[model samples]
Target: MSQGRTTEGVRDQRAELAEANHVLVDQGILDGFGHVSVRSAEDPDTFLLARNLAPGLVQPEDVQVFTLQGETDDPRKPYLERYIHSEIYRARPDVRAVVHSHSPAVIPFGVSTVPLRPILHMAGFLAPRVPVFEARDTLGSGSDLLVGTAASGAALAEVLGDAAVVLMRGHGFTSVATSIPEVVYRAVYTGVNARVQAEALRLGECTYLSDEEAAATVATNTPQIGRAWQYWRDRTA
Candidate 1:
């Protein structure tokens, strides 16, 4: 793609991602915290992400182009403690998009010794394993040290493995996929799974899906994530 076209593609993805980000914020996924990032269509060395804007109010221009490996060239533009996004993109070539958020329920498993297993059909994606990156010592929310250091961020990426998401201990989550919609899809499921798991713990022993069963279940989730995207377009259009 030409530079302009590539930039346009990133911008387009940014708009779509931002729109989905708006959905997350509206549904209470993010506040001023959290961010959505997509690998730049033009160059892998670059990626697109929201700057200091609220996910609910993101605009095209508000999406910033950033180098995936280092500090941004411009000082005026405040880059997100962006390692969570960049490091994962660098480590997982299969992932084209990522969403990091500070959702409330998801935090329980992130900090607690308890695991956030797949207690619902929507969370079958996490059947194999979900790592609570027990790498942090202290901090508040996703603003933890993972975002501050590239090495820690890479450690965060390693925890994800082939899984769709990873919980940064004492922090939040970093969800990845081949597209913005996929990440958003997983994001919704991530929260839904947490809600179900929390409720299940209270009720009784919740049945968990095995690897094969979970993989098979993923194939059957036809309109799950796609519906999440459309749900936004329909409501926001």
Candidate 2:
């Protein structure tokens, strides 16, 4: 892909980024403190995100562009966890968007040994083992468990490696994808799968999708993400 985009392309991406923030909030994937960002189509070294605001309240003007090094041109401070998006973009060339959420339903699997699995077709992306990033291992025994620094962000990205999602032990989780809509899709379904898996575990054994099943479902569902995206966009609008 080219490292430059037309003015219209940039404007459209900004709107999509803003819409992603609201869609995530509307879906309950993000409450008061989560964030979403998209890599700048005009410049591979930069990405765009809302500045230190609740996802639901983000407006187009609230969006700020930041370098891959996590530096922003705006005088206002960016999100403290902005490094999560920066370092992930630095590490994963194919990833165009990232979402960091303290999704309530997904927290248990992150804090415990229970693995988040693909119990539903919509969340087939979870078939790949979701790696857990323990901040203590990278930041020391007593740390805030926040990927606040470039070093911490890089460490978390290393754990994420090629996976669609990574669980931050005791913190939350990050979802990555090739587009903002796909990342939002993964983030939403991840929470749904977590909730369903928990309920199933309480009842009895839960039969997850097999590897082949997951692959097939992903192939079938990936192209239809526009439907969900449109629904979310309309609902939020």
Cα miss at 116, model 2 (Å)?
A: 0.7
| Local error of candidate 1 at residue 125 (angstroms) | 0.9
Clashes of each: 0, 0
Taking the tens digit of each residue's C-alpha lDDT, what string does model 1 give over 1-237? 587886677668777867877877876667877888888767787778877777777876777777767456555555556887888888888888898888888999987777988877777888788877776433344443556677767777787877888987667888888877778778878888998888888887778888787887888884466876788656755
Task: Provide the lDDT at 142 for model 2.
Answer: 86
Best by TM-score: 2
- Where model 1 places Cα greater than 4 Å from the true spot, the runs are 2-4, 137-146, 222-224
Q: lDDT (0-100) at residue 18 of candidate 2?
A: 89
Each prediction's Cα lDDT score? 0.77, 0.93
Error of 1 at 49 (Å): 0.7
Clashing pairs in 2: none
**Model 2 root-mean-square deviation:** 1.9
Q: List the residue pairs that clash in candidate 1.
A: none
The CA root-mean-square deviation of candidate 1, after full C-alpha superposition on the true structure, stands at 2.8
Put down candidate 2 lDDT per residue, 1-237, tens digits, no spaces: 443547777888889998999999999999899999999988889999999998888888889999999999899878999999999999999999999999889989999878998999998898768899999988999898889999999999999999999999888899999999899999999999999999999999999999889989999999999999999999999
Error of 1 at 105 (Å): 0.9
